[model samples]
Every structure is written in structure tokens, then in C-alpha cells.
Target: MSAEKTPGISAIDTTNFARQIVLDFEFAPVPKQRQRRGLRNEIIEVGAVKLDYHGNVMGEFSQFVQTEYTEGVAYPVRELTGISAVDTAMAGPLYVVIKRLSDWIGRYSAQVVCWSGADRRQLLTECQAKHIDPAAFPTDWADLQTFYTSIMDVGSHGCVSLSDAATWFGIEFDESTGHAHSALADARVTAKLLKQVMDGDYRVSPRAQEIRQRWGGWASEPRRAFPRSAPS
Candidate 1:
């Protein structure tokens, strides 16, 4: 088979494949300085696709969490994500959305997957600020971008956007899934990439473990379901 047609990794490798739930997060945009300082990029949306070991999507989740920022939705964020103050006017608060997310996660024994370390860090930051139970979050995570780069012989630090990765790997991204910033659509696309990358064997990168440690790894905690938040 041509290199383009060959699956680089084995689909059945338990180390690489688990019941995996690919995740993507879109946060309320803050100024570049604030974002770099980890000052205020609140997660406005959460999206995920639950996949079986064989890469079949089993389920999906999406939520638009309301923000508490007083200035209202920033225009840049709205322009980029297509999420406006009006869009999230009736959405649940972050805690409520997180509660629902935890419930959804309980249905599967799956590892959380995302494009990079940013989403995991954002989750940790948000959870820590709210005093939300970390146990509610997925413990295991794998960065698909790092994995993709590694397998494709690109340097570990290569800059590959989601669209670029999909194009490189021959994965089809559905444009009708809405804009790139929509979390659920991004999650579905990431899951598709995961399926492609997992078709061959690759070792887990140190970045995965680093992300796990930053979030305090995994711990079991009692589940608490919040009554969905009311419109602000």
C-alpha cells in the first residue's frame, strides 16, 4: 500500500484505543495578554463525541455554558465563534453544564481526547475557580495533534490546525456541521482524526502524561447533578 493509503497504527492496540471521547472546547475570547496570563478565557461551549475502540462514534455531547462577564459577549469572540450574548442568553451556567457533562461521561469508560493542551488547562482552570469537583472531569486524556504530528514525521512542535490535520490525513470534515468554532462539530472532526491516527501503532507521548498531572490526574468523586441553570 502507498504511504498515503496505509494505516500507520493498529486499530486494535488497546494502548491507543479505548472507549475514547474526543473533546473540543471553545472559550469566550479575552485579550491576548489575558489569555496568555490565564486571566479570563471562560469556556462558553463544550463538545464531545464518544467513540468505541473501533472508532465508531457511539454518542455526542454539546453545551453552551453561560458566562458571568459583566461587559457582555465580546465582539471578537462573537465574530470568531459565532456565539453571541444572545446565543447564550438562555444557556446554563458553567457549573450546570459541567454537571450534565459529568452525567454524560458516567455512561462510558472512555479517555478524553482533544487537539492540544489548551482545552485541558482551560477545564482545570475553570473547575478550580468554581471549586467544582475534579472527579467529574475525565481523568485520562490524549492530545491528537501531538500524536498526529509524531506519526506523520512532523516535529512534535509543528503547528497543525485541525483543518490542516484533517486535510493531511485524508479525513473528511463536514462543512455543514457549522463553523469551526462550534465545539460539537470540532469534537466530531477530532474524533474522525483519532480514528485515522489510531489505525497504526504509536507510543503515547510525554505531553499526555504532563496534561494528566496538571489536572491532578484521576480520582473518583461523588457525582452531583445541578438543576440546570436558569436564563440570566
Candidate 2:
């Protein structure tokens, strides 16, 4: 791919097309040992991927940010994501990542489905800390949790972890993709899950069209069971 052409937008790439656009996020422990009150605050890294409206993975973006507030030590997150300060910093800075993110998002035309609903809060937190405007991104983003909670009201799984419902639908998970802990990996998986949900194979609330819009590739057919969104 030439640097002159951006992914997803450039249909001529031929190799990549038909992918939907979504953002993924992952976090790891700090380095040695600082300290934070909540597990959410110690984000050591962030990542993302871009897909066109048709479900083809166009390209990717990632960042391994350095920080002063969070503790850099062994925590449950490390075991889950395998993120370390050494590897995380290689991705780049939040400003660089966030700026790229904004450029990638373009217009709100699509929705955002996230593994965790708290992603908005965390992302905004990063923006605030950097004195950047969080509102610059779309205010219309939604979380997959909203869809999962309404569908599987059983108090979450034993692992209490997120999975790409799309990957789960597949006969076998793609292990070669490696562990699904990186922010971009998680984001991509969630985007895939959104695709699965819209596949009509799963039962979601009729009003889940919003979620579908976030994940549905342009080629994906709309489900008949979806209820129209209420007028704002």
C-alpha cells in the first residue's frame, strides 16, 4: 500500500475493501509501581484498527504510551493482555495516536461498538489529561456492553472477560491472531462481534439497529427484526 493512499477510503487498493470502521482499545499495567485507585486508571497502552463499511480490514493504528500516574507492576491485566511498558512505549504517544484516531474516524457516518462501555470514559480521561477536547469525537458512539447486558442478563461469564461474538460464532477461534488483549485487537474483535450480531444468527433487542450500524459492513444486509430507533 502506498503512503499516498489511506486505507478503507481508497477502494482501488483491491486487496482491502468491504470492511467496516470501528475503534478498539486495550490497556496494561504501568511499569514498576506507582498506584491507582481503580483498575481502569492504569492504562499502559492503546491501539486501534480501521475497516471500511463493507467489513474488510483496511489498515491499523497503535500506540504504546508512557505515563507518570499509573503503577507499572504485575497485575491481572498483564496476564490478560501481555502489555508491558517496554513493548507499549514502542507504539507512540497519546497525542500522536489520538490525532491519527481523529483523522481516521472522519465524519460520524458510522457508529462505534466497544468491548467495554467504559471506553468512552477512559478515552475522555486521556484527552482531558492532555488538555485536548474529548468532544471532538462523535457523541453518538455506543458500547457492546449495552447489547450484551440486555441479551445475556446472567451476571456475565465466570471469566468476566469480553469476547468477539463474531469469533465465537465461527467454528474455531483464530488463535494465530494471537491473544486478544491489545487495545486494537480488542477493538477489532468487538467490531467483528458487531458483525456477528447483525448476521441475524443471534437474538438481540429489536432496537439494536444502532449497534448494527456500527459493525455492519456496507455489503451486510440489514436484519428484518430490528426495531426502528425512537425519534430524538
Candidate 3:
């Protein structure tokens, strides 16, 4: 189903979906040679949280996938995500991991929600590279970042990072939930933000207010980003 915008708030209508799988992926850039050959990044990890319309947790999934980079993950990737090559060495292949994730999704018709559209594009690119049908996995996807921006009434280019968004919502990232860059941690934070938006409990933090001012918008009251309505 397509998302409809709320009249004044310009937020997306998300009540039509049965469930949402908040997903995230950690990637390592391919070797220069592969990049020359048109390959970009490799999926090193996958993490997701399944949530019902009201934002109740239904299940969770996390997987590390073996990548072609045997030498090890790049220094930057390692530093950002703390995911070393050793962590993925014992993991299964990409297709296998994807299949397992699909199985975990089960028979429920759900929408895959990502912090941004990047994950969806990365998944499709990897599937194409492996000659795997992208349709084998849930293709119905939503970009939570877009919805978040709309809810905040920020300019298109004024979208904030996931960590920043979390901070705006007063969500603290600590050792318990890993850190900002970890795939599962990011997914969990995104899920939390989604719940806050759905419940109309989101507030524009000082930082978010700066963003709104810089991006040219007046401060507005916090409103539900996604309004619940009767199913079509």
C-alpha cells in the first residue's frame, strides 16, 4: 500500500501495514579492483527488529555474513562498527543468510523499514551481483528517514543522522545496546524513534530546532508522524 500524507503535518500514514521490520546493514567497501569492475560495498552484517503496527516487538534477527574480503574489513569500517573480519569468518554465505532472514519474516505480510533507502538499494545491488532474485526477500519497503524529515518539517537535504535523531529523541546509546554504528543497535534505535513518532511523543530537541531554523521552518508542535486509521 502507498503512504498517504497527513494534511497539515505532512507525515506519512502507516496504519495500513500489518507489520514493520526495522532493518539495518553494515557494509565494507570492496577492493579497489572490484570497485573498478563496478562493485561498491559488501554486506558484512544484517540486523532487524520486527514490530507490530502499534510498535510492539514481535521478533528479532541478527546475522553476520561472510564477505569476499579475506584480508579483513577496512580500518574505517572496523573503527566505525567494531566488526572485524574474524567476526564474519564463520558466518554463512550471503544467499543463505538472506534466506534465513526471509524465513524469519515468515508468512506475515510486512513492510521493511530502513533508516534510509540506502539499505534497500544495497540489498538489491548485492542480490543482482549474486544472481539472486530480489523478490525472494520482502521487497515492500519504506524509508523511515523520509518520514522523520517530514514529521520534523525539515528540508529534503536537512535530514539528520540516525545517531543525531536518536539524540533528539533523548535516546542514549550505551554499552547495553552496543553503539551508534552497530547494525542491530542502529535498528533498535530506529525502531524506538519510529515508536515515538507513531505515538506523537517526539520532540524537537535543541539540535533539531537548529536544523529546522537553518533549513527554514518555524517550530511546530509535536504531532503523530503516522496516524492510525481503519484498514482500507
Best by TM-score: 3
Candidate 1 residue runs with Cα over 4 Å from true position: 1-18, 30-38, 153-157, 201-232
Worst 10-residue lDDT window for candidate 3 reads 1-10
Sequence-dependent TM-score of model 1: 0.72
lDDT of 3 at 82: 91
lDDT of each: 0.64, 0.50, 0.74
Number of backbone clashes in candidate 3: 0
Give one clash count per candidate, in the order shown: 6, 21, 0
Q: What local lDDT does model 2 show for residue 100?
A: 68
lDDT tens digits, residue span 1-232, model 2: 1111212122112122233455666655443354333334645665565655444566666666655465453558667777765665455566666666767766534455455456666666666655667555555445554454344322323111354243223422256344567676666666565555444245343333333444452212323333222222
Question: Over the full model, what C-alpha lDDT does candidate 1 score relative to the true structure?
Answer: 0.64
TM per candidate comes to 0.72, 0.62, 0.83
Local accuracy of candidate 3 as per-residue lDDT tens digits, 1-232: 2242322122233576677788999998887766523448889999999888788888889999998643478898999999988888888878889999999988777778888778877887787777777676765777777666655544455766787667656776887567888888889888888787567567656665654566566656444544565254
TM-score of 3: 0.83
